[model samples]
Target: MRARRALLGIGAAVAVTFTLTACTGSAAPNDGAAPSEPASASGPMTCETILRPSFAEQLAELGWSAQQSPFRIGEHELAEGIQCVWGDAEHATDVAQMYGWAPVSPEQTAELQQYLEDNGWLREEDGDVVYLTEDPDVVGYLEEGEYGMTYQFASGWVALADTKESLDLITWRG
Candidate 1:
């Protein structure tokens, strides 16, 4: 019985040592390797980041400011991304411009394209793609009445805006 107890104790000690080594071995904080951070940490996509400098200046000239908001297509809110509304800050109802940017999988892009087609949004001209030159593989769509536009980038980003000019002002690096 005493021999068995000694063996058990030895096994327990070995197990504890293995566990400690395993836990600490991979957790070296100062091994000269760069720390992992989210892609966005370097330059996050926000209302400011997405806008062209001239457009941002124009909005400022017009006394318009941007505020974060939820992005929606008709009544359906997108699950991820950043959306911004630009207008008079004091009057909440005076918001006349808005934009949104979201990353999309190829499948999601196809679904969005279908959704736009089904809802009667017109496909924009190939030349219109020049507006967002940062994304060479972008395609644009336009909706009348409300004057809304949507852009799908092959880089896996989708942008929505209330006006074509708003679309023109966007620059996405995704």
Candidate 2:
């Protein structure tokens, strides 16, 4: 019960944080880009069973492409080759803070980076620091603190984030 209350409190704090920022998904387009995601329906709401097919279709609708070989880290799968990119932030690095898109403290960034590293989602660098994945194209930009969010699509599995902050708070990582 206490744990549940704490969880609820954290969720409320996140909501308040965003409400104060008043940011939207209106940042610059991601890359040279492809067709934009449908305003009303970006794609579909997916889960473990429907992740792959739904994700592929969503990216396709949004202009992101996939490659044959996919990256597998633990239970999560990653796709490669970006068909197209679109977001307010240019590169993955600033997908969140470039504008009021999604604000994150430096401490949150460290917490998130460490979380990914402790888990299998990140790769070790020189035995100490860690990165999201092996692909250079797979950069980190959309970061969510504590229960952090990351966006790194290689080829197999990718989850689209509506906003930089949304990427951080994604319910599903793989």
Candidate 1 local lDDT, 1-174, one digit each (tens) = 353334334334533544454466532221112236433555867777665544556566657789886655656566667788777576554334666777776787667666666666666544323112212122223212323344544446667665433454455534
Candidate 2 positional error at 8, Å: 32
Q: Give the per-residue lDDT digits (tens) of candidate 2, residues 147-174.
A: 2223333222233332233333322221
Off by over 4 Å in 1: 1-42, 91-95, 125-148
| Poorest lDDT segment (10 consecutive residues) of candidate 1 | 130-139
> Which lDDT value does model 1 have at 160?
69
Model 2: runs farther than 4 Å from truth?
1-28, 31-101, 123-174
- RMSDs, each prediction? 25.1, 16.5
lDDT of 2: 0.32
